[model samples]
Target: MLLNGRNAVVYGGGGSIGGAAARAFAREGARVFLAGRHPEPLQAVAEQIRSAGGLAETALLDALNQQAVNEHADDVASSAGSLDISLNVIQHGDVQGTPMSAMYLEDYLRPVSTAVQTTFITAQAAARHMMEQKSGVILAFGGSGTQEPGQYLGGLITAFEAIEAMRRQLAVELGPYGIRVVTLRSGGIPESLPSDMEGREEIAGAIQAATMLKRAATLEDVGNAAAFAASDMAASITAATINISAGALIDW
Candidate 1:
């Protein structure tokens, strides 16, 4: 139980990555609060956790809504008595496979704006509580990385880079309060992609080929990494990006 008795709030907890992390957090003895726009998926994850003898709760709300996010954080802290961890994995609405030259302006900026807005709102809400406690972990996903030529990933990389910058700044500001901020950088997770996604095989293969380990990260790997990062064992880790890309991304 790495996170025994901890209370964690996971934005976008209904998604694949978020669900995985939530499950891991619950398994480690943390009472997980899954927040997302959809009720069904959130409830599904919650049910799974309960079935496995773990504690979990679901909240239906938009992560980008500042008021909603703030209220949710307040509610969680009030009920749980402490907010130990915060993780935001909301989708950025990125449009991939379109060259920048031909991409619409809104399409290119959607992810950037969405990522920043939702992350800022959620992190700020968590930071307020964390500062009061003088101890907490704020986790972020999608670390910056080099984009391959012809990849046409649109603004996905840009959005990630923006988040990395924010994470560093948050870490610096929150450090004095004993709040740790870290980003989990992954080359990609094969299982995260939809089974019927266009060019799914090629994309997964490219991801594997790009990784030094010849294997893309799995949902389980992300879950494990997130649990460790959010736990007290990682108290000394902050203002940093945990490389979970299996060599796909070289830090140095």
Candidate 2:
């Protein structure tokens, strides 16, 4: 119940990571607002939460739409009395596994552009309410770090780095209002990959092998970390990246 009485808004709440975080938030006594472009998945997560006796709601939303994002934030704050947490987990449309030289410029830049746009819109919308209440937590997925040579991740790494930069800037600007901004960096989550994804086993193996613990982060790990990071127990933690990679990412 670390987040008791809090209100958390999660973009892309239908996705694996988002849904996990939403459930965790609700379990900790937060009223979770699941927002995404799809209704079915969002509703599925909401129903699960409600079945568990947790407060949950769903909204069909395009995180890319600034006006829509703003309106939604206003509505949530108006109804909930405060916006305590905001997390953007929207897909960035990244085309990985293709070498930059062979990739189209749009494909190379799509993730970078989409990541920044959706994050900015959602964070901005939440910030307005957070600033008013003088307290909030803006959570972001992904973080910048070393990548293996020839990984051919396209702009995925670049997109993550861009988000880290933005997170730092936001944390600095929003610090005065007691709003904390943090990013969760993971090596990889095998459960997040589709069962039929190409080279799925190899990819998961590589991810596990890269970590010192020989295990990639799990959806549950992410949920637990997210709940802690969003809670008052982490009030002193901000402008930082929480490494949940289990040694997959080594920081100096």
Instruction: Count clashes in each candidate, considering only residues at least 3 apart in sequence or on different chains.
Output: 0, 0
Write down the lDDT of every candidate, Cα atoms only: 0.95, 0.95
**Candidate 1 lDDT tens digits, 96-192:** 9999999999999999999999889999999999999999999999988999987899999999999999999999999999999999999999899
User: For residues 147-236, what per-residue lDDT tens digits would candidate 2 score against the true structure?
Assistant: 887678999999999999999999999999999999999978889987888999988898898999988999999999999999999999
Name the runs in model 2 displaced over 4 angstroms: none
Instruction: Give each model a TM-score.
Output: 0.99, 0.99
lDDT of 2 at 188: 83
